[model samples]
Target: MSTSHDAALLKPGFTDAVFEAQAGFRALLDALAYAGRITTLEVSLDPPAPLDPATAAIALTLFDFDTKVWLDAPAAAGPVPAWIRFHCGSPIVSETHDAQFALVADARHLPGLGDFDIGEDRHPDRSSTLVIQVPALTGGSATRWTGPGINGSIEVAIAALPEGFWAQWDDNHALYPQGVDVLFVCGRQVIGLPRGVKVEV
Candidate 1:
């Protein structure tokens, strides 16, 4: 646990915490409800190093005492973890499998989707949700997506992910009702890719 003085050294959470969190939560819901579609998040907060505004906002909105978070190397160091502990009150875990939500600062070096909790057949909703920070939301290799939330087919692009990201995602998609979901964040934008969604590069 971080002391109050340690937390005070980090950047604060949203200015209008309650309202901002509510608005951010709505944006997150909208993103997930329309998988593969990018949604804009507007939350006023200066998060610590390694945490983008969108990721930080999502953390504040979705995480609570009930959730366990896993922070990647960069995010685990410095004041970022302390800030999350102070604002979200979610326990930060060391193992990826132990996390309900995982935050990765760099998508290019992100671990395989299979590394996280995929949940059981009867409780697929308990699977881990990964928040990955990408360079940009658009202008990269395009991938086609089709799933429940998507009406038909939609093309989406994310910049600078590792080489085998799509391959790993393909394997994850094959898991159907038992795989981790993903949220790609860049700047103040966020896009969802639920476990059921199929992606074709």
Candidate 2:
């Protein structure tokens, strides 16, 4: 049996694979450097529905054959997994704990941070990175952000995250170098929230 998402195998990824992936990678780096600052993606893509250009761009730029990806319920039930598998050459894992990256198209249904690998002190870099799709990068309630890349602090109001997510984030941040990092995306805009960042409501 082939599968439902098999059709996604033909869905195109980056228009200019090498150039666009590099550009997208650079954009992500800048987003992380600024931590909560918006960095728009310049890549072109006809990504599967629910996977916006920014989210898809990050996947294409970061995922490789060795990376294992986990999708939220909505994404896994759609063509998202197949698209990632085909273009990124990443294995789609059923469990979040085993994934190097977790694409959360439906953050309202997001799992606890503990569900994914949070890495150990000795291997902090082994933690999972989450790409969460939010409604917008701004125009929601504001929360104060302060951390390594941030000189002072920035107020960010990312819309549509799951209930208790911020509280969960507090515990995650407490893990310091062992917590999962997050990238929030809306349309072509993305904002990185590394684990080292602190958020205050």
Candidate 3:
């Protein structure tokens, strides 16, 4: 009764899950600390289809038994969810609001920032973190970012995001310590956008 999808779900994760996840975790930390700066993930992984290597690596690195994840339609119905379940032991939730992390494989259909969890004033760390996959990490329309991590401002490019992304970000930024943070993945590169950062298109 097993299908090809089931078989794919059984595939091994990173070649060295612990070490690879550790390295990826460090890279992600640096990306977030620097805000708009692009950080490359040099982890070896054989991720399931529809889940890019960078995205997959991040899931493995960040999620644990205590975390809950929400995957987009394409990723949820595929082997990617099962792969994460097997490797990361993170529960996959049906509601975006319940997720600690939301994996958006297609940027075009990304959910509005308000739809996800924006932690309450008493516990701001409860907010969801978005891991969005994009076409390219660089060479698109420029967006100027400024806030805690930058000296003055930094211009970065991210290709193929949903329309009104910046408008939504404006609202998200206004939430201050309660807003969700984002990590954009393209190929092996990742760029972070923390809640405190301001983005001008």
Model 2 scores a TM of 0.94
Which lDDT tens digits does candidate 2 get at residues 1-201? Answer: 236567535578877888998898899999998998999998768789789889989998999999999998888888787788778889899888999999999788689998889998899999999999988888877899998899899999998777789999999999998999999999999999999999998
Better of 1 and 2 by TM-score: 1
Query: Which regions of candidate 2 are displaced past 4 Å?
Result: 1-9
Q: Rank candidates, TM-score, best first.
A: 1, 2, 3
Residues 1-201 of candidate 1 have per-residue lDDT tens digits of: 877788668788888888998899899989988998889998666778888999999999999999999988888876777888888889999999999999999886588899999999999889999999998989989999999899999999888988999999999999989999999999899999998899999
**lDDT of candidates 1 onward, in order:** 0.90, 0.89, 0.90
State the RMSD for candidate 1.
Answer: 1.1
List, in order, the clash count of every candidate structure.
0, 0, 0
TM-scores, one per candidate? 0.96, 0.94, 0.94
Clashes of 3: 0
| Candidate 1 regions with alpha-carbon error over 4 angstroms | none
Whichever of 1 and 3 has more TM-score, that candidate is 1
Off by over 4 Å in 3: 1-9
